[model samples]
Target: MRAHPAVGDCLLALSLLFVDLLVLLSQARQHHGQPWYVALPLDVAMVAPVAFRRKYPQVTAYVILVLSVPHSALQLGIGSATASCVALYTMVVYVGRRQAALYVVAQLAVAVLQMWARWAPGITLIIIVLIFALCWVLGEFVGARQAYHAEVEARLHLLETERDQAGRIAVAEERGRIARELHDVVAHAVSVIVVQADGASYALRSDPAVAERAVRTISDTGRQALAELRRLLQVLRNEEVTREPRIPQPTAESLEDLAGRVRAAGVPVELSIEGEMTGLPAGVSLGVYRIVQESLTNTLKHAGPGARAQVRVRRAENLVDVEIVDDGAGKARALVPAPDLPGGNGLIGMRERAHLFGGILQAGPCPGGGWRVHATFPVRLDP
Candidate 1:
């Protein structure tokens, strides 16, 4: 098994202490009259304090300073001085700046005492000051680097958390788009159904043939609505109806049938196409069909019965313009703009569709009488 970090640190301190003890032993052997016993205890006392240098830096530094002052004054060996430098380095790195300043002052006081006792202001005092200053400066540099790395790690974590929140917000906005698309589909289908059913009811007794034709139109319109609904639901399902022929999405051509159904429901709707609609991209084409369909739906509701509506699609080299206009003179014209009261979902959906193609939409009361919806789309999207 690998040694724990704290265990490794403790062993490193003990190793430094053993090295200082060996140096003291050697110095005592070389210098006669020093005595091995006195050197052994003093050297052990000075170096052993380093074992708790980081854990209790201020206390350990004081202990090492106290042991070394007497040992250095007596000129017993170099071991005490070496251990003092190591303890001061540990103190400055771990005990904080204010305590380090105090430790430095205390060490300088000991040095002055030694100078006065020896009566010699020489190279020894200068060497001790230089060694202590070097250790404290090195410790401060190491501490600053560690603090910088810690700050960088904190900033990176904050950025990651913000990224996660942004992703969730994007997903929520997408779900809202899908919901709006579903609403447009259902609203358009139900409007056609209700109109057709009313006509069939009125003509049921007076004109059998006319009523039968209206019922057939109703059946066809229902089937088309079901197909559109199936396409919408496929987005949520894992199993797709691959066995059936893929349903064709609405395009410029599809507007012809849409107009016919609206005309049969007692609203006179005319669809006019200009330029090259076939060359437009699928997304832009769908955009054209949906905007016209929604506008016509709003017209039938607001324009009421016997109202005439016009849908125009004009394609240019790089732009396509669509407009739907009607006269607000029908029976239900007053009730048609109910959704436009405030925060209308229909108008909101149409505007969002125009914005999806980087297009502009203008919708409001027309100069003549009824409402008008006009949108412009870029024929070719930027690469």
Candidate 2:
């Protein structure tokens, strides 16, 4: 059977009571002759209340004081008076300071009256009061110290919890940023490949030359997309590596290669440059490349077979503008059913990549029977 808390406390109180009683008996035996019935019985009555001292400290203390009177009156064992002193000490230690103080004054008065009536020594009264005062002060100091330590520990625990919460918030924010980057990379690449593949598939049966070009376009687009994906993964894996190798990244300079691939996919792309293409930042170049790739890919998928596409890159004083327009009918049957392009995350990716370069992208069906994608980036590169 499980023991209740009170039962455990009672058992400890009993054990203390036994030790106190044994000490009292031994002291009495060593100093005084064997006591008569009055002394022995009175000593037992004074010490017995100590067993319940923890449960009813004030009551036990008062009972010991009351019983001390008769035992003293009958000239009982001095050791019995010592047992009453032990009970008084227990009360002062366990009970509140205010109550213990009041009880101490009452017991002192009683002790004084008894000693006066018997003509006891003045030195003994002074010694007994000094002992009681010392025990009371020590107990109060220990209790206050325990309470102070507990408060400090509670505050430290609260601080640790707050620190953990802040760490979790930071980690969640980082994950959100990483997810956005991944979406931009995958959407732009996949959208372009799908459009090129569709155009190539349509030209395969009728035009052998066009069909071969389309196949080559699809292969090149797939390879470029894979390289971009690998670069992104590498950056994520070794985040602490401050310096990166100067690997070649597809940028505006590579537009000719991009146009060649798209033309091979059976979509003829006419490219035009209006401004000097010098001293462009790497990030800006990459952004421009992705925008054009996405636009041409969309043309291949939505413009249908035999679509003619136009790509223009114009650099002004503070801005660079890129525009792609296609003459084929807008969007294939699958894209038309779901204008948003079901399960396609391309358009969204393009916009995000453009935004990263401090630019804006616009893509939709033009007033004419075709589609257009235009992007503008703020130029920050030094001339």
Candidate 3:
């Protein structure tokens, strides 16, 4: 229901002009001898500047104060006092207190000169002071309220920005976690299936039983990979929360079964544990298991014929250590560093897992003609 500022100001100026016209007509009817020519010009000049009071507050106010001097000397009717009060209020609200104080002083000086020149009553001065004081109070109250609203709006905007930033950061972290999980599941299973398929292709003519075993291994590996994939995809669903039980994530104790699987894929993995791994935190246990899993999977894919790996896990009082080493017999040349290659994130994914649990991982060609990966994570045993 609020109008534009300029339109409102124009309407206010016109209303004041109409009131001044009525006052002039009344004075003329009462035979005060105020001529229309002089009084009409004075009234027009007084109210005209008010239309632009908010746009050029200080200038409009000063112009009105200057004109009030002549209007008072000429003994014009109530229009002079009304215009001065409006300008004073405008200055206080739009300009500021310090400037408005100066305007009030100038206005008081004009009032005193007019009263003395006319020998007006003391009560007249008292009424004028009260009216101007009222205007000043209104300006102060409105100005303070506006400032409070502005401050509250600014704070709300800042809080909204922080909330949006936090949401984006959380989403990015979840995506990275999912990517690592997918890479571990898909890469390990596909490598095993490819190796078994190649072995089956050749053993079908020489040994039917070995071929059948390789085919069976391929079938099991595929099913396991599909189940892990489905579990990962479920996390991305947006359906209402349900109480469906989840498959438990593999931990450090599951490394024995992992080693047996790698041995079936033509890479013999010897796993050794030095200390108790019981009651380890879920995140730390998962990290240790993944680091070993990725290392042995790399050996299966790149380590040449006759390659064998050793996996050692040591759980200490405040930390867990994992080391995987394989004799480098992969391909004619040692496996080329694939860190920058597309679809080659085995090392990257392993390092990310370790760092997520406050750990460090190192992977490279060992000095004694093999590949070695070592990782250590800090953890506290649960009582």
Model 1: worst 10 consecutive residues (lDDT sum): 334-343
lDDT of 3 by residue, 1-383 (tens): 04588888788888888988898888899989469999889988988898898899999998988887877676666556777888888888889999999988888887888789889998988998899999999989888887899899999999999999999999899888889888888888999999999999999999999999999999998988888777777777656214455667778989998898889888988899999887999888888888888888888888877899999999889999999999966443245463223235878888888888888887776655778888999998777
Ranking by TM-score: 3, 1, 2
Task: Give per-residue CA lDDT, model 2, range 321-359, as digits (tens).
Answer: 998888887533323432233234667767776787789
TM-score of each: 0.70, 0.48, 0.81
Give candidate 1 regions above 4 Å deviation. 1-8, 16-122, 125-148, 203-254, 264-266, 279-284, 329-343, 378-383
Q: Which scores greater on TM-score, model 1 or model 2?
A: 1
Model 3 bad stretches (over 4 Å): 1-22, 33-45, 48-52, 66-83, 105-109, 112-138, 240-248, 274-278, 330-344
TM-score-best of 1 and 3? 3
Local distance difference test values of all predictions, in order: 0.76, 0.70, 0.84
Clashes per candidate (backbone, < 3 Å): 0, 4, 3
Candidate 3 Cα lDDT to native: 0.84
- Order of quality (lDDT): 3, 1, 2
Mind giving the per-residue lDDT tens digits that candidate 1 earns over 117-172? 88976787888789999998998997888679889999899989899989889868
